[model samples]
Target: MTEHTGSYYAATVNKATDYPPLIGDQSADVCVIGAGFTGISTALHLAERGYDVQVVEANRVGWGASGRNGGQLIGGISGEQKVANHHKRDVEDLFGELRWAGHAIVRERIQTYAIDCDLKYGYLDVAIKKRHLREFEADCRRLEKSGFPHEFRMLSKSETSETIGTDAYLGALLNMGNGHLHPLNLCVGEARAAESLGASIYEQSPVLDIEKGHRAKVVTERGSVTADFVVIAGNAYHALERQLRGIMFPVKSFIIATEPLPENVVAQINPRDLAVCDPNFLLQYFRLSADKRLLFGARFNYFGEDPAVIRKSHRKKMARIYPQLADARIDYAWGGTIGVPINRVPQLGRISPNVFYCQGYSGHGVNVTHLAGQIMADVVAGTAERFDLFASVKPLVMPGAHLLWKPMVALGILYYQVKDRL
Candidate 1:
């Protein structure tokens, strides 16, 4: 099997762990499939609640999106406002409470587990158009009315340029509450935390199938895990169930890490070291690493895993934003697939009463996945209020999504690209 610790975050992981593959029949109170953030988060939550949990991963821990994400901890779920609009009630109270809950969970977990992932606070939601500025102003107003604890300010054009060293944006909404981190380390550290709490994790053990009933049995190549409930948290990399396969499209996002910049260059650009995301359907998000490298990311028409091509495409975009970085050497380039539902909301529901699944967070996986893990855990524990809020929104499944995912995703990207330009 390929080594999982080759990614940039992997190279700098706080700790290295090698767990054996599942080799025999095992049983637990819950069996989770896939060891990405969703699976690991769910397993960790259940284990913390004193449940016997066994996690089965196709690769090593954090090998999928969890290990490969941009690590921006922006709050709020995808399409939450639209979902709340459908309830015909005051969802402000419900969503307002849950909006920053994931952020709280992340901060508490980092402190409680002592996960060394270079966690920091500060982010900017930048605007490129007058409409974007208006929306950001509205967002700032809402946060102010809600008495947001963190420092949030609306930046003028000059302030925006000063903060980001880029005149590409018209203005920005800065929030000290949001931040970035080393995602893979957090995932691995959380898995370790779960392991310490008596949870069992098996790597290189892809789940072949799940036999569902009162007690679900997850069958791997070399072992089987029987549990009272089964949680499928694979997100976009999952292939175990046919029902979820065709329900969403896997869109590829790529990122490139430039060599650590000079102190003056770093000071000139991103002096505050805050994560920044543009407001566009096909967006670009970037931030500086603890080692002082500019990690830039974007979506493109490509889907292959060629690092050279990713570097070429993403470097050009990065240079467009900051021309001084045009000659910077790219140290790392990689891509990962994100499961995007048709309606842009996260998919959380049950294939069976004893089997629950949550996936398709669009690009907001980091924050939403943690909240989802909590919701999934609550669902298994017979708390369905928050679970139902998401599960009620059924996924819009395409006719041939599984068979034609590539073409479909390419078309969707093209559509979004056009929309972003307009």
Candidate 2:
């Protein structure tokens, strides 16, 4: 059975899951093939609406990207513009509430289910270049025009340094609507909530095939699920379906956690406890963990999981921003894969009449996955307005991209690294 990666989130999980693997034939109103955020979120949504849901997983809950991400609750879909252009609709009319719809679902679940995942408001979109600040000006205007209730403002260079204790960025845009949380705990908590509502979850049962028909049969190693509908929520980790292959590239990202800092150190850096991300294709993001450790992540060319290697590269980058952390002891380091579509849009469509699939959130999985779950439930219930909006845009497929993903991703990262410098 596949286990959760050696991530800080995993080590500090509220509770480890030991769900039984699939064993025999089963039936349900819907069978979701994944236990990550998308699957659990969908299952929880369906259970709330009185659907008999069965979820099959290849590993423990939140083991994939859903559990091992940067945990940034960033607002907005990845590629909303492309969707708007393709449909010839105004961007705001196409996606205003839809952009932050996932954030609303997350907040509601945390409160309704009493989930304790170190939820906090405040985020920074730091600018590494002057052009980025101009972009922020436009974003701020849009927020103001929309009458965004949350506190948001653009910070000057000096103000940005004062806020994050880093002069690496020229400026920043602070958005309270966007924040961070403990993703693994949130995912596990949601799964537990689904269980309480009568949804069945089978972990460590990797799906082998899907026999599409009136009622699709999701085949696993030891058992099979024949449901009226099947939902494929496995993003980057799943490779069983041929239809999904080559549609998106799997990009690897790594993160390192520092030991809990001294109170003075914490106050000196990130006193407000805000998540920080720079505006770059090959960007860097960091936030203080609930225990006060700095969790930093970035995309590099390395594909291996050796913590030592990850720490060596990330520590250097971290120190470049905060010199005081130059000697800080690194406690944990890990990596995960993200499904990045070529066009940067979230891929939501049908593999068959009753077999639905959703993937490719780029790096915005935490917030978007929750909204996607709701949309998936809506699609199952005959409401496809939101689903159709995303489904209308066909994925820009790269032939044999999956087979040669490693080299392709490496080249892409190199290209972005060059672009970021320009």
Candidate 3:
């Protein structure tokens, strides 16, 4: 079985899940691949809709990027502006509802399943540039126009410093709707909930290749699943399908968790207990876990899996923001891959009529994945409005991109780092 990385989330989960690996042929109404947020969320939605669903994972549930993300529950899809601009006709009236759809799903799931994932409902978008502040103002306006029910306010430079105990940001936009959580725990809880709804989840069941037919067959090493519909929901770690590759470039993001902070220290920084994110391509995101430890994450050019290197690299970056944490004891570090599309639009379409795929959320997987789960279920159940909206945006397929993902990501990081400086 593929073990989960030594992430802080894994270490402090509500409970460990030991799902059985797929060893025999199984039949279901729908077969989903990759037990991360997308697959598990899709399964949960399908099972809740009274569809028999089975999820197959190459590793432990949420073992990939879904388990190791920043856990910030930021709202809106990545590149929403670009999507709305390019497909204005298609998204004109419904963008507002679709923008925060996943947040609603997440809120409902957490409460319905009674999942204790340390879910909070506050976030800050700290701005480093004047342009970023402009974007924040526009975001605030959109929230107002939509009659959003969350408490949102902009913090001036001094207020930003006081709120986060940092002078790195010129200002910040606080949104009570977006927040952070224990993502692994959420994934596991959702998986358990799906199982409770009669959804079978098999761990360590790496898909070899899929056989497309009237009833699609998902082949694994030791077993297979034949279902009326097959959903490939793996985001960044998926490699079973040739067409899913290259269209999305994989980038590495790393995170480090500090030892529990003192109450006074916590009060000084993030007193509102809000998830914080900066405005840069190589951005820094942070939040205080329920236990009070500061979890900091960023995207770096480095791609290797060395916890010490990750911790050291991020300790320096974190100290730059919160210098008081210069000597903060690092308790855990880990990294995962994010699938980014060339146009930054999430690609949701089909490998075949019966075989569906949903991926390329960029960095908005936490919220968007649940939204995607809903859309995937809708598509399978003969509703395609939302799916068609995304599918209409042509995915840019870069040939041989996956084969050269690492170097390409390194170059992209270098380019974005320079742009961020400018």
Candidate 4:
């Protein structure tokens, strides 16, 4: 259960960060747990605002999904349209303003902190069926109607193949606003920025218990932190709290990074270097790393920490998309868990007035988590407009969600497989 780092992103992390574990009583305006994107982002936001903030992590910084995820910077929130349907307000007007807020934040953070995370521009939402093409068309129309600042266009079958070197997609919607980056470096760089702004961070300091009150006391094995407010940013990796444990199901997603290919192979595979994602319910997302290696990701049935099994499953899926890569050597294989709420909307609310929580971004964590951090900071400061928007939607908690996650996820995979086929 204990490993330093196995993914290619971890192997090449620009800087390694180490902080002393919590060992004595401490106090702060805010204390965040988990140390992933959500925790780091929130601490950064708070610290920048002149608030005293501290972050405690059970593992090293960016050790969870934040470091291991496919670096696709996709737009929009998952299941947002459904939530919009439930409201009387113009969903477009309300969410459109916030849709790209995370991207803007990410871009600014990279520039401000001088974080080199192999950031790139351009992405394609590819379609596997005529229905998916229709969806893409609708999305393009929406972007135009919303007066999107980015260049967005729909590609025909030939154009799609020319752009991605794959014939599996019927069509695609190209959005320059969406892009990719090295996620581990981004998270760590953001943590550095937060620290520079006076946020204290402790790694390998897992919270053992929380004593809730007007000011909560977060207890670790050897130390504790009392704070005006506590934010649980642990998401799927967290197991400390009973309320969080079984509310959201942990779904494992795997990825394989192939060894850098020949220049011609790279040219033939992804000429424009756009990140590509398929429209299947059980999705496949791929993009080129800065060093010109293909990073392919897919959802599979196997669970546990066996990298060999993960590599085999993901490699087969990669070959299916581009048979020319049947012999591509996989350089790294790893898996991470994503918190999937029953409604597919990210859960944001207060367990107590002084104890706030945010989790369950499904597979949309990269973009949405930043937005969530901002919303969380806003909530801590008494601005609840955006927070209420999400909190108003109740999470669908399944019985024994933590214990039955494996079987439930298998069922979901089968269901999405059928849906994708239809």
Candidate 5:
């Protein structure tokens, strides 16, 4: 009865949020567009700071990639190494704090709000090639140097198989800090938490236009929000703002959920309940759900949402890693878009002095968006140290990215697939 994609997450959420559609003019200290993770998270942060906040969503809350992702809470921002290189001398001063800020925010929100999103700890980055192993080794040293609180270890080829019950990976880097959760539920819970903090959210209200001035006016067909500051938090599904179109490539990722497996099968695979990801440009990630279904994800260039097609393409990829599930029944198949900047840096900057936009987290939305939310709130509250660090870096754009995204993404995928073999 709504616009949300028919996915397993939608079917199983305990209860749906019922925020009203915007019908009359409203006002707040801050108005946020796109009520996904970023918008809700920012609103929560601002409300916690005693700022009056209002959030406007084009559809239901988290009705985009924020809700449809693989639910992997992988640590570190996308392109941390490259972004840190922009400020090499301060790498230790900032990168260490930036790397885990999102993870800390997530853990704090879960406990503080009592969100029931099946939150768990543990993750494995599986190595597909020796180079991947080297990268993992390098990352392990970084954590060791920083005195990471959680456990992290580099696993041997045989140890990788023993840990995951699959021989598909040559090795793995296990990090207890990275983990998984029911993302849709987490988003809804955060929205509710924001509301309890005095933030107002309007659902099913597509932002028609924004009038920029000393005070920004976020307009909808039926209502408008006048606020001192406005934030664009739509990420990849954002098409309302023309200035943001070329800043990132809107790539698609698909996923499928197998029928709940027996306990014996679950024990054989992913017994530690760790989210698993591979080291490839076109990579696959998977983990067991709260109910024991294997939610497998594959990154690719395709953009359509035909369930049969996604099921077919993803089933083949999933089989390559876990042949035991070759014949497993697929209960759900869906796709979501990711905003990927060419430089792979998360974009955070101002469209105008009083209006800010944050997007292009690549596939690192779950973790980075939380960090971006905090940074955006900080900027709104007259603190710009963290926000300026990201905003100052120029976002790399693919030429004609808006007009020729599909062909460009196809070529990009081919280039990576070829390079992965080398």
Candidate 6:
């Protein structure tokens, strides 16, 4: 079995999963690929509706980006504006409710299943540049126009510092509708819920190929599963589907977790327990853990998984935002890959009539994946209204990009870093 990475999430998971790998031929109403948020979420949705579902994963549940993400339960899908524009509809008119649909699902599931993932409310979209503040103002207006239920408002430079104990941001937009949580715990809890509903999840069973037919066959090394439909939810870790490659760039993001801070430090920094993020394309995000550790994340040039190397680079970055944390001990450091489409849209399409795929959430996986799962479930049941909205905007494939992704992503990040400064 491919073990979970040496992440703080792994060390603190509620219950470690040890599902048996696929060992023989099996059948189900639907066979889902990958066990991260996307696949597990889809399986739970399908199982709830009484579909016989099975999920296959190369590693443990949420072992990929789902387990290792910054855990910001952000709202709004990436490239949503482009998707709405392609249909000649105003974004808010078309997706005002749909954009926050995933957030609703997350909240509902947490309540229904009693999943304790340190889920918290309140988030700050901090601004380092004037343009970001303008964008936040636009966002605030949109929220008001939608009759958004949560308490939300813009904060001035001094108010921002007072709220978060940081003078690094010029201003910020505080939204209680969005938040953060323990992503891995939520994923595993949902997986357990799906299992309770009779969904069969096989861990360490990497899909080798898909034989397309009226009943598609999902082939693994030790076994195979025949199902009426197959949904690919691997995201950036996927490698079996040749057609799915090149449609998105694999971008690496790193995070560092500090030792539980002293009560005084926690009081002076993030006492309200809000998830904080910047507006840059190469963004920096941080929040307090349930135990009061500061979990900070950003995009760095390195791609390896050496904790020492990650800590060295991220400590400097974190110290910049909170200089008092300069000597603070970092307890954990890790990295994970996220899919970034060329146009920033989440790609939802099919390899064949019965073989569907959903990937490339950019950095919006934590929120968008839940919505994608429901949409995938709807698609399998012959309802494609929401599915068509995303699929209609075809993915812009970059030829030979996956093979050269290392250098390609490096250039792209360098470009964004320069742009973030402007």
In model 2, which range of ten residues has the least summed lDDT?
A: 92-101
Candidate 1 residues 1-422, lDDT tens each?
Answer: 35663457777777766889999999999999988889988998998899999999888898888898898999888878768876765656768768888888888889999999999899999998899999999889989988999999999999999998989899999999899999999999999999999999999898899998989999988999999999999889888788997888888888888998999999999999999999887789999999999999888999798989998898889988999999999998888889888888789999988999999999888888888888989988999998889888877888888889888888888898888877
lDDT of 2 by residue, 19-123 (tens): 899999999999999999999999999999999999999999999998888889998999999999999999998788888999999999999999989999999
Q: What Cα-based lDDT does every candidate model obtain?
A: 0.89, 0.94, 0.91, 0.89, 0.90, 0.94
Q: Candidate 2: where is the Cα deviation over 4 Å? A: none
Q: How close is candidate 4 to the true structure, as a TM-score?
A: 0.98
Error of 4 at 110 (Å): 0.8
- Per-residue CA lDDT of candidate 5, range 216-327, in tens? 9999989999999999998888887777878898888899999999999898998999999987878899999999999999977687999999999999998988899999
- Per-residue lDDT of 39 in model 4: 95
- Regions of candidate 3 where Cα sits further than 4 Å from its true position: 90-92
Candidate 4 — worst ten consecutive residues by lDDT sum?
A: 1-10
TM-score of each: 0.98, 0.99, 0.98, 0.98, 0.98, 0.99
Candidate 5, 233: how far from true, in Å? 0.5
**Candidate 6 local lDDT, 293-410, one digit each (tens):** 9999999888798999999999999999899999999999999999999999899999999999999999999889999999999999999999999999999988998799899999
| TM-score quality measure for candidate 3 | 0.98
> Could you tell me which 10 consecutive residues in candidate 6 have the lowest summed lDDT?
1-10
Candidate scoring better on lDDT of 4 and 6: 6
lDDT of 4 by residue, 231-269 (tens): 999999989888877778788888888999899999998
lDDT score, candidate 3, position 312: 89
Query: Which clashing pairs does model 3 show?
Result: none
